[model samples]
Target chain A: MTRDAALLLPSTEPVTLIDPDGHPVPHVGHDLPDPQALVRAYAALISARRFNDQANALVRQGRLAVYPSSHGQEACQIACVQVLDDGDWLFPTYRDSAAIVARGVDPVQALTLLRGDWHSGYDPHATKVAPQATPLATHLLHAVGVAHAARLRGEPTVVMAVCGDGATSEGDFHEALNFAAVFRTPVVFFIQNNEYAISVPLARQTAAPSLAHKGIGYGVPGERVDGNDVAALLKVLGAAVARARAGEGPQLIEAHTYRVQAHTNADDPGRYRSADEVTPWLARDPIMRLETYLRGRGLLDDQDVRGYAEQAEQAAGRMRAGLGEETSADYRDLFTHVYAEPTPQLREQQALVADELSREEER
Target chain B: MSAEKLTMATALNRAMRDAMHADPTVVVFGEDVGPLGGVFRVTDGLTAEFGEQRCFDTPLAESGILGMAIGMAMNGMRPVVEMQFDAFAYPAFEQLVSHAAKMRNRTRGRVEVPLVIRVPYAGGIGGVEHHCDSSEAYYAHTPGLHVIAPSDPADAYGLLRKAIESADPVVFLEPKKLYFSRSEADLTAPVPPIGRAVVRRPGTDATLIAYGPAVPVALEAAEAAAQEGRSLQVVDLRSIVPFDDETVCAAVRSTGRAVVVAEAAGFASVSSEVVARVTERCFHSLHAPIRRVTGFDIPYPPPKLEHVHLPSVDRILDAVDELQWEYA
Candidate 1:
């Protein structure tokens, strides 16, 4: 016979539950969250998912060239972003537009950057975030650099470098963490451990048993969080941010989650994995699991569901309307943006560009 | 004109001292560059005179040093970063390529970074491969940076001073082998414009082109050729980028046959570009194909092989021999 809660086995393992229907049950820790706060997180997740959907549609319609999905990682994004204080810096990877949205960026700005426009999404300082960088693990050092800047300026700021699990395989990642740990720079590295990196599996990525343990090599504390459980993620991120803001150097966090869809709208994962492998995770979906837990505690109902759907739809509609309404960047932007003082060579190059453009106009 | 005899190293130190004295925002820092006075002592007594804040030693990390300099530059400070050796610049490449060269373009001209990278460059020091390598071509190919090398005490003082005062990011390549070589420094007059090349000696037969340490080699070759009654014009292409094609074209048009020389390798070298531009601008005016006397097309050799690898006085004379011979 099983014992009661008081007589249960003592273990350091995280709390888990099983649904009565032979399905894995969800956690109630985040279920007990405040209604307004939960709605903010829910609203952000919905908006991000809607934007991801529309961006793919743009790619298919040929309005945009490529789209990388952030569909199933919405909870990990919103939860981690909730703990950032004002003036906190983020070195975001290419799959981090959801976090960027939560960090106060207008969706059109991301569209412009994705369209290969010369201007970045937003000023790194103005939005407290750098534009999404595509090169794997390179932005990790940039985040450490930002943390060092904060240390020198005596500003109580925490820098978060968010990347995928595949990014840990890069030398720059280890270099950044080692630098942060040795220098005691105020930085937190958040890895959204989404199972695949454009088709490369995490199992093929590392042999350390867990991605979280990789930080130990650099003498930094690390944690593993249930990324689908918004409450667990928020709690872990809040603690990490607090430690960093207190000048305790850095923390490494591995947010374990699964992608309920393909790597992007362009690919079919069926070539790699079966529908059966992903079916179970969809039933325990991040937003769905949170919604069920909230409903279990009487925090959500039909009306709340209706409101979130309406908000997400309207936001998507606004974005769809604003897609091509933004200004188009010119070729002059290429050489103009490179140097404050365009070298004599650049000036000559621009003159050559102008001459060619003028000839094209004549034709 | 007041003249003083100083080695190339002392002249550089004096020029830097004058710059730091003239501008409050000029900052200097790198490895072993403070109390130890740099490996070559080119920055000797700088820390003592300017205080530790302005001239100090940085952490051993190259990326960290450059990353901090970029931050300082963005914050309205003109930082002069010393990349310990020519090859040490590789570690700082990301900061140079991704940030320093692109900050203005990435920001759409809203922000400008006027950072200067001063590197002790090229071979002839009894050092190994990395120390003797010439990386000027790598930076010259980058679109946003201005790369320039000085061939003499006067050009070194003037170009470095101008690079410090310039509003753009400049790669100041200091020829390491010439640092200790004694030179006459004219303390009286201001240095000339950095963007133009000067003709050291006018010749009617062939144009001998070079810059930095190679300029002296070209000069010596011209003097030796003169004893043989071959009038060779030596043109010093001081600034690599924004090359003084006005003077180069004029020289090529007059001399008809041009012999280019560089310490860098012949294949895809800076001199290769020089050959192309001079050939293109003065195509029909050519008395013979543009001949380039340069380092061999291989990884920079050891100190023992350097004499053969680099373009020496004999190599220049050989290139002239290959050019239209006016000896008859």
Candidate 2:
């Protein structure tokens, strides 16, 4: 279990397995996930990066209104998703582009949200997931509820709720942790400590050392893992998930990562942090780490690497194609989904719009 | 009949138990609900009868209790989440609004969160602030969430069942003031439907609309007006949000005058909607402006001062007294 105490928090104490130097530590047991699993994780992360990149390009091309990239933070997301079964649920926040994708949410689904066409990124019921909650830590409590319900049903399903580090400032985070701990609900809270919540750094968010160590107050097992280390993250996340599924309780895993890309398409990281600051995290990239690790094992070659890159491109193209197939607005659906059975007031509004359109057409 | 005269607390227990027996999907959760049987003992003998799993105690967090009900509802279970008090629910409002209310629509008609959030809502029991305060208006404003409140035991049973059965998330506001107000409530008989307003007394002078704590106040005002030769009609508006506009409209159209009464502050209340809608629908029928007998727009005062804050028999009579009744 993760010992989440102030002493282990990253601000007061450093939280890294193999530092940026790529040197492995002996005490920190790296139950390194299988090499094949590592390759798989790298593939998904790379694909997510491609998807985010393509979407960014599309945004610039006047396709999508905005796009948030999971550029340097795919390790924690894909790793955590690898730990859970299909029955398990995921509660993702606005910036978790990769996390939502790994939870069986199509990249194109989030386009609806980016286009401001719909509130939900995807069908939560179909994926056993929840809509991407734009609000910060508030949905964390709902994730806690999912676990509590699983316990009520005598089901062994666990809910892994993902959020950014800055979300720790919100009262809802404390409530969710306390509830999960007290109830012993089967939940794993994955904090993708992406360094900044749209500009408010982790420093402004909490005085309580590390985000992981802060969970001790609620008595939930907490740990900080190298968000760039897919192998380590998956291993720790797998065990924590197993513990929750075993009816032990909730666990908080803070994935220490950096957002190498802009917070979203609209954000300018240059104003807050310098390009020099992002240089170090860029070197410790999750995709590059797994790629380097696989190369060292001789399990992958240059040709295979090129093939994987091609697959990422193909996946992005397919996602772009899928975006085209979505239910378009036609200006009619805009007024449709507001309510199930449109109120008389809304219907009147719709009729008025229709009448104006008819009059224009007659002209 | 298996029905016996019981306190409001005991009646809630019976209704919950019967609900569990009627549907295996029914489950309840709140703080100290298991062996403790809740702080008020309303859930007493329930954990024993239904077992700890079905009628269980949750952690101290009220948000978790309510949020989990939405999850259970998604999984095809009828979860009656108990908010220990009205104020504790503030933490979970995001879940209630962003998740619970929008889930069905967000899923594009693919999902329904059939959850019941039972809150011991209202003041006068002197819970200070956190435990008191009638904040039903907040839920009513949020679409996709159904809001219902019941004063008497009979309506409590039927409405609770209806709320549990409804496919939408329901905010079931239980008046704490009426929890111990014992009276004859038929358990065997089916009362008026959950959302319908029941006309307790029929008259043409004015329509007195109320629910929860204000229902008794409205009834008392109707009786006092009758003694004064004033034929005031009373409507027990069972549901607050997605409020019984049809029923409230019917009463107002019949009487041609309206007085909305509630334990909450008169400012931007669920009753505020009632008055606006009533006046809008029955505009020409008005003999006088819509009057409201409500709790003052201030913090719930001390126990002694609570009488001054909440609507009393005298306040409604005062509002009714303001009206010009045309009939003999």
Candidate 3:
């Protein structure tokens, strides 16, 4: 075994390609993504910011049960989707609504779980994205397994499993990384370190220098990046994805960012944090930072920004219309899909439910 | 039929061998399952026969093994994962309950986790705690999972093969105590599909419903009752979740009395479900209330005191004796 920890350790400082003021920074460790890709990422970030706002509004209107807003972490969400190929899979967490939407899933369908209509709104096989896991860190193992299976089948598929800093504390997280490294599976573990897991802070979550550093013991290389910087995220995550796809092994990436909104609409951030902490992240907003950088480079102009805004509004309008419609769930659906073929007990229960429905209808 | 005296361990090995040979998608992995051939050797020679890709050993993490199995299943491979022992699988309960059991339903049939978790369970192996436990009730209580426990060599081979072929996830409970139990198994015989109870020994006075490790004890009790001039039927329930109520109730209705037996604890157990179902369907034809012969509702005891805790032949006979034979 190679005793060298240099290859496995993350950079001393998180890699950043663009500063908070939107100026390009010199980073010898990593290179920036292409200008076109950065512009596309900027477009996604704008749409995602609007998507988070629209979802939060829907929650208030009682159209959605709850929404975990990825308001400031749009760069990580968009980069997670943009860095992957069509054949690759993405295992997203419950808070990754933005990533799911970025992957081309219908916006309304992406909110189905929040709308309380279904467990998962879209088909996983069709989207190549596993259903957003509510339970923490469990899906990471699934991502590793999918990557391992792809390798076994001689398929060129790299799986990107994304979770929050809070999930890094879970045992499944350790198991997933260890399994991936041991098997040399094509998986890139992306951690959107949004500082807190609900009320818990990063300090309380782990004593490790960084979440990425935890991967060194497992022999999986780690990389830390500025999650708010799209250029940096694209470059770092893209390199990790390419490395994994090239049969180098799994990689762990911890993206340092902040969750500007509460953990969910139900949560009160005031109970744990102050406005002073929230005010700083507002100025460091991912969309504005990327817009500034792209504008300086002349890749994006005023007309282009207006066009992106109109597109975002149209997308949000479509989501509003789709979510406003009534959802009629068939009572019989409860008994279906539990198995390939319903068991005798399920059939009996189905009959009971049908009888109850008929009796209610008669009354 | 070839007269080959086979053990349950060997039968299970042959089942995996056959299934792997038939389907290239089938892969088997678990701790100590590769070159070690597993502690019980149920996976003996699998590695030699199918290479590391098909038959392998995984890290000693139950959740990881099970979670990976679900992923492999989703990606078009049939993973037959082992939990090493019954109690050891507790760590993966979340994976089993949340994902393996709910994936298909959660995805609205868009995805199916066609994986089998083989857990060697029940006491009588003189093993320490965590090595021996009848954990079938935990899996049986979960929906969208087929909980199967075979009592003999033939059933073990057949059920495991059927489990691998199932489109839905299956929790296969292998009784460690009976791993070496020998029988003249006809491997070529077409085994019955899941969700069917077999009348191991048909009788009339009372129905003895048992499964897994409890079957032999119930059968011996039936034999003992025969010497005492009492007819006791033995019913081995192969599958728990998709329970064979038709077969079990039919036997109970014929006997007019039922005695449910299992090595697991009595309260809210598989045996309790059996008693309730039999009582529900055979209530009118019953002469006496159904009785349950099960392990105590306490933590499993040490090996020295396990006999007193586990359901035995005497306990089944006692339950049968308590079935109000006065009416007959």
Candidate 4:
């Protein structure tokens, strides 16, 4: 049932496995992930940061319509994705492109929605990931549904639904948690508490002691972790995944991190926050902290760090090249896939558009 | 096939039974749908026959229920979800409009949400406020959804089965008032394909286009008009989204006059669409402007004033009288 009272009690301090200076801190009741897994996580974190930077650059170059950068929250994204099996599904929000990429999606494919594509770039069924939902908290319900159906069919699949702190305030969020708790679905809700929801700070979002505590009201276990600490995130998210797979019901995780960049290229963070407020979060960057820990463990040398950087650079170059290729838009896509079989009305509309296009070409 | 006199409610129940028996992936869920067998008893005995896994009750959250149905549908399951009342479905509008309806197109055919949302709609059973709203137009205006409503037992059984078997999401609106109406029909009859209209009565004088709850009223008006020596044809536009424009326009073109009938509000209603399409296609053939007999444009009034607010037999007759019969 519920965890021990000590574990359930709300704490202002996040559950962390590594301090800001890159030293490993012992967790009382949790076991750190293997050193090899931690090292692999460090690489993925580096890759995510590089990918975010490339996407942001594309927006400035007029290649991408916009981008939501997970600049400082890579650990939350990569660590949570690392623990999922091939059969498990990941329901990601628009801001969770890093998680989507970490789940084996191509960088260009994951940015399809932000690129103004008609639909998701990749096949969700093939990748075992749902489309990146733009509307807030709606994917949580879908995640619960998929997990519930999997349980009904006796499948050993779990679901990881990722959302932001602001999304927790939506009615769908409340409904999702309540339904998941009632049905005991194998779902883990990962909320990245990145301090501000497009400039609205957490203090204005809710009066609750912590975002994770919201799960307790629905009877689901809640956990908090320093999002920038890859080791702690891996430990907490891995445990949550295990609990769900064991049919122990859903769990909520609040990853305490900061959004180092603006919400999007179109957003101006200076409108609501000052430089002083952002300076502190930059000091606790997830990548630098993990690099320090790996160096301390003698698991990473200067050459190894350079190799990871090169790998990230190569991936970013490939992404940039892929996005630079232009593809013409098919106007017929407007009518296609509205239904499995296009209705007579849609067929008529398609013909009208075709006629208009042909007339324009003749003119 | 054996034939028996069955009520619309029973026909719907048998349809669900057949769908679940034929397809293991088909699941039925909603509030009070399990042990209670639904408030109107339409889902009676389903849980007992199919087991709780296939048939179960859900919490009173409409958004959650529909949201889960979308997820289930996306993942190799056919989920038939019930919205206890028509107005109660408002809470799930975001999920329906933003996700379930758009999933197929949004995923570029890679994903299909084969979901059937069943809502008991319209007035006449003395229900008040949220229980009696006619909100079909709201769904019809949405681009990626298929909207259908049935007026009789046979269509209720057949259309509901077709909806569950469809590859896209369908908004299946059941006429709550006609749930208990009885008809002699064979449950195993070959159902008609969706998105086609059926001419219930054939006549050359004029066309009365109606669907759902207003079909019976339109038929009554046709009967009274026949006695008055004004022959009237009755057309039931069963599927509203992919409306049967050919059938409707053909009838209206021949008669040179038309009257569209519905229980929903008159402004921007399905009836309005029907009238506009007919007028566009049959401008030269029409001897008179097409008229519409629909509920007044206002919130569904209290039960006592429902008869006045809703389109009645008199209203249909009045619409028919407004047509230029002398010119015809």
Top DockQ prediction, candidate number: 3
Off by over 4 Å in 3: A1-3
- Model 4 scores a C-alpha lDDT of 0.91
Task: List fnat, each candidate.
Answer: 0.28, 0.48, 0.85, 0.79
Across residues A187-262, which tens digit of lDDT does each residue of candidate 3 receive? 9999999999999999999999899999888998899999999999999999999999899899999999999989
Better of 2 and 4 by DockQ: 4
Worst 10 residues of 4 chain B by lDDT: B319-328
Model 2 residue A234 distance off true place after TM-score fit, in angstroms: 1.9
lDDT of 2 by residue, B48-160 (tens): 99887788887676666776777677766788888778888887787888878888777676767777888888987866756787888899888777788887877877788
Residue pairs clashing in model 1 are A337-B104, A337-B105, A338-B105, B151-B212
| TM-score, model 1 to reference | 0.86
In candidate 3, what are the lDDT values of residues B163-265, reduced to their tens digit?
A: 9999999999999999999998999998788899899998989989999999999999999999999999999999997999899988988989888889999
Tens-digit lDDT track for model 4 on B1-328? 8789999999999999999999999999999999899999989999999999999998889999999999998888999999999999999999999999999888888999998999999998899789999999999999889899999999999999999999989999999999999988887889988899999999888899999999998899999999999899999999998788899888888788889889999898888988888888889998889888888999999989888987887878888888876775
* Docking quality class, candidate 1: acceptable
Candidate ranking under TM-score, highest first, comes to 3, 4, 2, 1
Ranked by lDDT, top first? 3, 4, 2, 1
Local error of candidate 4 at residue B23 (angstroms): 0.3
DockQ of each: 0.30, 0.45, 0.90, 0.84
C-alpha root-mean-square deviation, candidate 4: 1.2
Q: Model 4, A275: alpha-carbon shift in Å?
A: 0.8
TM-score of each: 0.86, 0.92, 0.99, 0.99
Q: A63 in model 2: Cα distance from truth in Å?
A: 2.0
